[model samples]
Target chain A: MKQFLNNLALSLVGLFIVGGLWALLSATVSPDLPSPWRTWQESKVYILSPWEKRGEMDQGIGLMTAYSLFRVAKGFFLAILIGTPLGFMLGSSNTFFKMFDPTIQLLRPISPLAWLPLGLVLFRQSEPAALFTIALCSMWPTVINTMTGVRAIPQDYLNVARVLRLSKWRQFTKVWLPATLPYMFTGYRLSLGIAWLVIVAAEMLTGTPGVGGFLWQEYNSLIYSHILLSILTIGIVGFALDRMMGFAETKLRAI
Target chain B: MSFIELKDVSKSYGPRNVLSGVNLTLDEGEFVSIVGASASGKTTLLKAAAGLIPYDKGSITMAGEAVTDFSTKASYIFQNYSLLPWLSAFENVNLAVEAAFPDWPKPMQKEQSEKYLQMVGLGAALLKKPSQLSGGMRQRVSIARAFATEPRVMFLDEPFGALDALTRATLQQELTTLCRSVGRPVTALMITNNVDEAILLSDRILALSRGPGATLSPAVSVNLPRPRGADLLMHDDQAIRVRNHLAEFLLAGSDRERPAQRPEAPAASKDVPVEASI
Candidate 1:
């Protein structure tokens, strides 16, 4: 309890320092900049009654956050569904690895934004273009990590499996899956973080009904306070999602 | 018929031969130990006998049946005590029990796992993971796993090689007790570098020349009485004599290249003079 209070006090001091700088800058250097007080007041309008919706482009902060979250979830889920099996095949079979590894290596380093135009052209829709960009960007970490995990399984463990003559299904479930799990979770966490980052950028580009699009729209009208509010929302949500994945990883490790 | 037989067995990796013309035979209910210097292909020979690896040129049979791959009737205990890191001690043993007796009920499996673990003095460590246990304790779990399967043949590759001296002695005595107490006959083929360990545990000891083209020496039968403990071996003049002879043989063979043709069998225990040294 004492440590917690000390930390809280330290956090408050840090916040005050930042607030003081922002207030001074806004007052003296640039009156156009959103003051800390203005940002707080503007953020309250959304935080107090966050579910209200006016129209397609004028939805509440809550609705926009939900939309962005749904897109991230869909893209991340698809990446796992596709990437995990490909990773297993690549890790297990030398022939499969030989065929696919070069292609994966060539493509992995390309930016998600580089795929955005192609996704937009192919899908011919804002939502799907965003999803495609999110999925493509998020999948590489999972594939690479899962492959490494599978390859790292101890030879002794496999020898044990062979000696026991375990059925193929049992071998997969009992040995391969558990052995590969910690690595897979590492991939999952990285993929989720990348997915969240991509979703925001993709949303902005697609001009869809999400937090990124809302921030872009607010910027167009020069509502710096609303833009600041959206930035805070995005950062807090991203941090929460990452923390949730960390919690899940810890739980699985304990098991 | 011999319970386990390896006839003219040879294995090579690329151009280098690890073992060559290694013929061995063991009777039912016999405990045999193969002692060799490091990298002398003792492990390779053990793996071939267990059918874990294919021999380049040879045949291995158990109970008149040609063996290929790993046989379900035989269990192997690795030198490193390869317990899965994620599993508890009980879970590791339970997995083997499940594989060896698929049709047995869960309660029976649990009982058998508990029984063997208790015999190896790991009953208190059932819930501990491999990382939590000491090296000696981990080996005890592996030993329990090997025995719980009740295999007709057990291939142990330096199962006690990693333990400290005190732990090794205690486990060796426990293993002898367990072997004696089992209801059915079991033939154990173990590889070790320790001459005293071989003398204490084996009914007969087979020495190997150093590789890359290793061949077995003629078998030296241990005439020591059963229920033999370290104390008995310490006090017995015959046991000390046997240990010295085996050590001398290993030391003398260290520098010479193994002969291309198989050497003639060395004289058995009866031929060696009681007063002979080195």
Candidate 2:
């Protein structure tokens, strides 16, 4: 209880510090800059009726956030489905790894935005293009981390498998899967973060009807307060997503 | 036919020979221990005998069948206790039982698992995972797992080496009792570095020369009475003599000083108790 109170106090102090800096900047610098007070006031309209729909392009903050989250979930899930099995194959077989490692290495460093044009060209649609970019961007971390996890399995465990003469299936299900779970989750967390990041950028570029697209529209209309509101919303949602994954990781480890 | 036999067994890792021209045989019910310096291929030899690792040369047979792969008839107890971290003590033993007797009903497997765990004094810790158990308790779980399988041949790789001295002695005593009480004869091949442990547990001790290309020294038979206890072993003159001889052999091997005289092969003289010559 004491520690919780202390943490709450520290969090409030941190918020106050940021608010104070913003207030100072708004007062001394250009009035065009959105202050924390202005951002909060602007946020109230969206917060009051977050699910309101004005138009296809002009939905409420909640709708935009939900759309963005949906895209991230789809892309991230796809990445996991493709990446995990590929990682296992690569990790288990040296020959397979040798064949594909260079290609993965080459493709991994390319930015999500760079993939946007390629995705657009391939799909000829903004929504699919955005998803493609998100998945492509998120995949590398999951694959690499999973492979590392599989490779990092302690030799003693493998020896136990051998001595017990555990069937190949049992070795995979009982030993390999559980041993690599923590590592795979680490990759999952990273991929989710990347997916979230890429979705916003891809949506912004493609002008898809999501939080990023809404932010861009607000920017075009010179609604700086709404822009600040959207930024705050994005930050909070990203934090929540990360915390959820962390909670799941803890639960899985207990099992 | 011997329960387990390794004839002119040799193993090499690429260009480096780990074990060379090794021959060993263990009859049913015999408890044999191999003692060697660190990195003397003791583990390699044990693994080869269990068919867990492939030997580059020679052959290993168990009960007249050529041992080419890991045999469910053989159970191995590792020094690290090698219990799946995700599994409880009961589950670990149950896994071994399930593997050894696939046709056994679930209830029978569970009963056998419980029996072995109880025998090893881990009945209360059946639900505890390896992470939750202490080093000693983990090893007990491992011992239970091995015995639950009712293996025709058992291989132990420094099984009690990781525990504290007190735990080691206690587990050693527990093991001796467990082995004697099994009713059916069990062939056991053990690799240990501790001389006293070898002397206390083994019917015969085979000392290995240092690697690479390590070979077995002549076997020194321990004629100490069965169901050996700590108290009995402490006061026994024969146990002390055997311990001293093993200590000398270990020390000499470590120092790279060959014994002045090499004894004839002791494997041929089945029940003959070879007195330790210092």
Candidate 3:
């Protein structure tokens, strides 16, 4: 608990620094810029009451934030579903590695943005398009990390597993998976963060009913406050998402 | 017929040779230690015997059957602790029994795993993962797992190399007594650089020269009395003499280094030779 608090405290320090810098810079550059205090007040007003503000769909900023988060989560989870196993196969088998490595490498270097149009074309659905883009954006790191982890298993462990005459599937689950989990989780954390990043940019292309579309809508209306507010929401939400992944990684690695 | 035989066992990787023209045999229930200065084909010889790598030349036979046939239930405990990091100590041991003896009943597996854990002083850590265990403790769990499998031929590759001296000695003593039990014997082939350990625990000691190394130097019978200990071997004169001869053979090729060339394997002789340096 003490260690947990220490880590939490450290993270709080980072937030404080970000707040301080933003406040300091905004005061000088744009006097009308959102001060940290004013932004917090505005966040409560906009985010807390997002649902109360009436519209045809009655979409409030809070509802919009929640909806965006839901989509981001769905997309992120989908990426993990697709990427993790690919990483394991590439990591475990030399033949599979040889077959997929070049293609993965080629695709990895191309921007996640480059995936948007291709995803839309392939998925044949705009929401899946955004999700697909995020998944592709994040998978490279997860796959590569997981593969490296699997490949890097110490020879000693392999010999022991072999000696024990563990069945093929048991060896993979008991020996290989556990051994490579830390790396896989590290990959998961990194990829999820990357996926969150791609979703916003991806939403722009697909115009999904989420934060990205919300940002675009506010920008079109020239509601710079809402625009700035959406940007802030993305930042805070992204930061929270990354932190959750980090926590998951630590807990998984310990296991 | 010799229970375990290596017929012209030779191994090479591409152009590089690790072991060439090597033949070795072990009697049933015998404990043989292969010792050499680091990089000797001692490990390769063991690897070939354990079926970890197929020899380029020759065949390995266990209990009159080709080693390929007896590949099942062969347990190898490596120098470095190789406990699956994900499983608790009990799970690691349990998994072994599960793979080998699926018909033995799940309760029986649990009982045997706990028994082995208790044997190795790991009874209290049944639920703890490998990362939570110390180096010595992890190796203990591995050793117990191997023993629990009732392996017909057990290969230990410097299983104590990473432990502190005190822990190494304790395990050595435990392993010695475990293997030497009269009713149900455990046949073991281990590789170690520690001469005292080889002399105390092994029935015979084979010292090899350095690598793409030379031929088997001398295979000596460790004539020491049973239930041996490290301090006892250190004081034994015959042990000292055998230790020196093996040491010279290891040092002899140190200066005359040759880029390793994997040798061709010789025909398997009936006897696993036991030369007494004394």
Candidate maximizing DockQ: 2
Q: Which stretches of candidate 1 lie over 4 Å from their true place?
A: A1-32, B257-278
DockQ of each two-chain model = 0.58, 0.70, 0.62
lDDT (CA) per prediction: 0.87, 0.86, 0.77
lDDT against true structure, model 3: 0.77
Docking class of 1: medium
Error of 3 at B29 (Å): 1.4
lDDT of 2 by residue, B1-278 (tens): 67788899999999888899999989899999998766679999998888888899999999889998888777889999999999899988888788778899999999999999999998899999899999999999999998888887788999998999899989998988888888888889999877778888999998887677888987889998766777765789888777767666665564453223224324443212222221
Per residue, candidate 1 scores C-alpha lDDT tens digits across A1-255 of 999999999999998998899899999998988898988886676777789887886777898899999999999999888889888889899999999999999988888878999998999998888888888889998999999999999999998888777788878987998999999999999999999988878988888889998999889978899888888889999999999999999999987
lDDT winner, 2 or 3: 2
Off by over 4 Å in 2: B257-278
Answer with 2 or 3, whichever has the higher TM-score: 2
Across B1-278, the per-residue lDDT of candidate 3 in tens digits comes to: 77789877778878777777777788888898887666667777887787777778878888787776327746788787677777789998999888888899899989988988898889999999888888889899988888887777788898887888899889988887666552575678898877767887888988776667345765888788877766665688888877777666655655344323323433231111212121
Give the candidate number with the greatest TM-score. 2
For candidate 3, the C-alpha RMSD (Å) to the true structure equals 5.7
Q: What is the DockQ of candidate 3?
A: 0.62
lDDT of 2 by residue, A13-116 (tens): 99999989988998788789888888888778787888998888677789999999999999999999999998898899999999999999999999988999
Check candidate 2 and list the clashing pairs. none
